[model samples]
Target chain A: MTSIAVPPSAPEHTGSRLTRVLGAATAVSWVVWLTYGLVLSPADVVQSESVRLFYLHVPLALSAYLGFTVTLVGSILVLRKNSAFWDQMAGAGAEVGLVLAGLVLVTGALWGRPTWGTYWVWDPRITATTLLFLVYLGYLVVRRLDLDAEVRARRAAVFGIVAFINVPITRYSVQIWNSLHQEATLSLTDTEMDGSQLTSFALGAIAMALFTTWLIIHRFRVGWLEYELDRSGLESAILERRGERTATEVV
Target chain B: MIAAVAGDAARIVAKDLRIERATGVITTQILPFGIVMLLLFGFGVDPALQVRGGDRSVLAEVAPGLFWITVLLALLLVVGRAFAVESDDGSLDALLVAGVHPAAILGGKAVVVAAELVVLELVVGAGAVLMFDVTIGDPLHLVVVMVSTTVALAGAGTLFLAVVAGQRGRDTLGPLLVLPAMAPVLIGATAAAGDALYGAGSGGIAWTWALVAFALLYSVAGIVGAGALLEDV
Candidate 1:
């Protein structure tokens, strides 16, 4: 289990009762979501069967937004406090957000093909989302740079703050240009859902949110362990060198 | 405090301009690269091709976007060079140690870059007009869009340059860091320039305002954030 040099005090794995329970809830919710969303929900009047992708697509998009929000918040806190925990949180959120955003694009494209008669269009939302993805990808790239951990954290934090500020500007700019995307089906002041579709969507959202949380928790643990391993590795290397010198002196 | 920052910024700007004048890298290398890119774009667009339903050639129609794209590509190089000089000689560290505020350093560099980009735009805009036979219907609109876009690009580019200043593989990483952040500039500038050069409508004014807003947004971000960004660099 301890394939790398980790302190014995470190947790053996990135799981606990809470994650396991969340994992189980997520699995059950997904199962219910699939049964209802795929099999039971009536086909859309306009989209026909293709609308089924919404169950996954909308939830994934929301999760991606949530993940990035976490990143943005984490980044802010990191900058303010210079906390390692926030740095790790920022990193984990970006990774998960990137993955989910990728899926959101794919699903969106897939849904667009049959409904919009093309795989892609320069719709305002899609274009803005694509830019958002690229920005975060850049954020992750910065995080991966070979630098001191504190330096990297600071850089990433500054980037995260700036990138978040860019998001709304991007969205508004594209929106002002033109839009083929439909109005929001789910927003603070709106809900365009029927009973069955709403139920399935709510379930999917719960499932995805739980799953995203679980993944972030695990990812955060992994990042924490890596940090520990790096520090411990340096210490052990120094100790080994010191021991070798002492042995040679004795010899 | 504000006066001190402005004073330091002016000195840095003068220093950068002097270095630029002495070296002429922008005039010698970056300007030529922009023209060459314009030529390459002309070749790619094929001067013979015309828009399907319009009297104008395809090149004329796309000149605005192509012009801005060329500017953006050149911007990556300018930003990389701007920071490269600072990081190469440890001058950036020296500036910090000399008690120049980080915001002033960022502002000074951005001003030089913005000025250089203005020159690049004028030359490149002239090149596009001559090569593509494009006309400027609203010169005022065109100038507004260009200046705002340049300021925004320079501000964002300088901040992002500071982000990757001392990192390894910054050449590759710089574009990855800066370009996406500039997407709105690309969209707004292209659309606004298209309107300006084509007499499309009143929409050019709106887009210009958007560009101005973008400029203000990034300038504020650069001023407020450059200090924290460069703290550990």
Candidate 2:
């Protein structure tokens, strides 16, 4: 039988010094955002308390878009370079983006219940975002398919590019379709922000961006470890098979 | 280069059409499935139900959505079958080994799916008309929307079908991937077809343009991305 040596001081987690710093920064910004956004900023005249949700909702939406944008760039890089690192980055971007997009929908719905008098409407942005979420959901499913690593990455990269192109086209079509049917009764961007409100929003956006970056970096590391483990496992299995063959031959 | 690609694509399309002709799956199975879906929509919407605040029946008013949804569902089968044959016999791998450009494969498959969908749409459109008793307000608009939407659906569907070609549980995954990607097609086609059939003046021409844009966009994506997607399978 083949024996393997274990490292005495291997890191037990995906975290590193940069991630630790990012984690601390994200935590500090969130605390600051919570203090200012919840207490210091004034509410809207029309939307009143519901306007507070926009602090999280808008930033979350932006982060979601940014995450998917990372996926798009990573996917392009994968196709151009055919590197496993790029594939891992693409997958991490999509996983993080899908979570953020899901949160955006939930926050939007929770905010909508109070402001729009309905939990959901076929508003252009909302519809397009929902479809975008589903599109990435499909991407994730493709990523999970059982296949050879290179084949899987190639397939996923192509899908990521195609799905990213779909977002703007979806938004445009939904916009036109919405306009043809009825006038938009409420728009998400109609809020008028004062100085404190703007500061709070800006803070929240920065915090969310930092947090999203932290999550994606961690996720990418985790995916890299997983790929390494899979490769090592295959190597050991092959080694074990060779060892068994040698033992039987000696017998 | 373009000519070679076109030649390969033409040969593939011819081969697929020959297989389809021999099997009669589209006519015998898929076409009936679409018509039956139209019937099911009629039953589900209730034949006697009238539209709210309108003189038309509810089914008549919603016939466009139902019709497009049926076409979309049927398109799944068409696409699934298109690639299933290739994958089942390992012909996809053979083709790749034979050096058929992936773009040609994509183009050929998409064209065949679009052709099948057009035939399905015509039969299903007739079914909707007979079952719902709706009048065609603009034949030209209807034809344009149908053609463009069919092409868009085919392009997106073929690309996604390629994505899921040899994967497990692809039967379900195929729709999961294709439907959301093709949502814009459903919306644009439904709105445009409604205008064509009911003269609702709901920017049918503009919606037609949207469908055309979708068609062109996916066609380009499929042609460009298929090579990467189908590299090994």
lDDT of 2 by residue, A165-226 (tens): 65565335435554422232224676445587788888998999999999999999888877
For model 1, the superposed segments whose C-alpha errors exceed 4 Å read: A1-4, A169-175, A236-251, B50-55
TM-score of 2: 0.91
Candidate of highest DockQ:
2
Lowest summed lDDT window (length 10), candidate 2 chain B? B46-55
Residues B105-178, model 2: lDDT tens digits:
99999999999998998888888888787889889988889888988999999999899888779999998899
True contacts kept of 2: 0.80
Model 1 Cα lDDT, one tens digit per residue, A150-237: 8889888889988886556533543365568776566566688879888888888998999999999899999999988888988888
Every candidate's lDDT:
0.86, 0.86
The best candidate in terms of TM-score: 1
- Per-residue error at A214 for model 1, in Å? 1.4
User: Which residue ranges in model 2 land beyond 4 Å of their true spot?
Assistant: A1-10, A169-192, A239-251, B51-55
